[model samples]
Target: MKIAVYGASGYQGKLVLTELARRDIETVLAGRNRARLEEAASAIGLPDAERRSADASDHEALVSAFRGCDAVINCAGPFTSSGEAVVRAAIAAGCHYVDTSGEQLYVKKIFDTFTTEAENAGVTVVPAANDGCVPVDLMAHILADRLEPVEEIITTHVVVGGGGMSRGSLRSVVETIDAIKAGGLAYTDGDWHPGVPARRTAITLPGQSEATPVMAFPVPEVVTIPRHIRVRRVQGLTEAALGDRLNTPLTPEIIESLPEGPDGDGRRTQHFTYVLDATGIDGRRARGIVQGPDTYGTTAVIAVEGARRLIAEPAKPGVLAPAQAYPSTAFLDFLVPHGIQWIIEDAPAT
Candidate 1:
């Protein structure tokens, strides 16, 4: 299976390349910076990896880069700007498309506009193929089966350690904050409602030292999951520490003040834990916990494995979420052998 990766020099790009190498799949690394692309491919031990120069923002260049590839994995972010162009190029090139887009608007737009075209083209287009929807998608599937009439679903993500964020990721964070400040709308109460950042709230994780404050944010998975599952409400939260020792709120000012390069100390180790809770009409509930590495690395792991499945399995052509594209058991089975742990529990009715 031959795959072309856009933004193939970023942190997530390198990790995905590494995972692809482990699976012995051929990859073409395409991005804006030729030098960075070469460096990342070499660092990941893919000496024979093909290199192509293409500006992600330029539609013509993107189309040329995607031509003749069986699949394309997009790690480019701020998807609000570059996503449509890439999707159009992938569709024109007759390739399966997958991305790590966490922007709700882009996901919805693709579902509405390109889903039919992709199906007609016999290509599979998957958005938010990373941790953004995979964990929550799995949780929602689990709860949908256990609960007779589910009312609401909430997912809280607690990420620890600063694992070297890339420029693309930083830019996405800034854009998302800007949108929130402008009073964006989120689906709530069975309708699109105005949404804002978290003021301040404390919550405890299973293996954490103490309770920490988490900021509620709008993520694509929150909107994506509810479309498949019958639920009245769904939300997502991202919680991180202020520093090495204190848990500080992720205020807009702080998000604005983040430095550009060398995001954190080289010795820094990162951790993440997600709690998924679902409530049903009969008072029965289900909760699941998933823990893993830094955000970028985890995303790469999911993307690479997802692509491998697409190559190795018999998959129908269409846009799908992680949980929908691959069987939940098949997906989770691949992760466990790679050191990811999942804990699932069912609560007795009270």
Candidate 2:
């Protein structure tokens, strides 16, 4: 199956292309930069992979690039701006679609606007296919299976490396923060409620030497999972990895002050560990953990693996999150050989 990767010049896009090539899948690299796309294709040793210049915001260009491809993996973002257009193009071209979008607003828009269209088009459109939604969605489903009447779920992400954010990721962060400041809604008290980034707290994880400070924030998973599972409360924490310092605080101001950079100078080998916890009505609890390196690489892995399965087996036609479209164990299994560690643990009852 031939797949087209949009935004093929960026870090995540390059990783996606690399993964697809590793699987011996033919790929068409679509992006705004011809030189960068060619460079990435050459780097992946797929010099003959088709290259097409297309603006992600241009529906006609995206459609033209997507034409004749079996599936398209979108690596472009802030998806809030371009996601719908890509989905439209995919539907128009009768191609399966997947993306790394983590914007809650855009994800809601996809569900509201494209669910019927995707179903009618006989194609599957999967969003937030990365760690943000996929792993947590899987965890929520597993937790719900073990306990009746789950009331809440939380995902905390502790990412150490890939310190420099891509321009698209940085833009998404700024927009999300701005929306929160403008009284945007978040899932709370079993419903969508107005919320903001509150405060920082220290958290100690198993195998860690000290408590790390994390910013309690709302990510898209918190908004998406509750719709599928019987959860009333969902929240997420994005934290900086801890080193020698104990209780190093990552204040709101510090998180807001992160540099939007030409990221190559920073340390390339970064690590991440995320814990997903859930609470049920009868006091039963479940937790799942995933650890990996290079946030961009992991995101690409998720997207590539999703596309690979979609093209190979053709999942049911509908718009879906990763967890809904693929079996949780199979998805987690795909990541194991790539150096990702998955663990499920039960917390002792108090």
Per-residue lDDT tens digits for candidate 1, residues 1-76, read 8888887887677778877787778899988889998888887788888998888667788888888788889887
- Which whole-number lDDT from 0 to 100 does residue 47 have in model 1? 81
Model 1, residue pairs in steric clash: none
Among all candidates shown, the one with the greatest lDDT: 2
Per-candidate local distance difference test: 0.72, 0.75
Model 2 compared with the native: what TM-score? 0.84
- Residue 80 of model 2: what lDDT? 83
What's the true lDDT of residue 180 in model 2? 32
Which runs of model 1 end up more than 4 angstroms from their true locations? 162-164, 180-186, 189-192, 196-204, 208-214, 240-268, 348-350
> Which 10 successive residues of model 1 have the least lDDT summed?
240-249
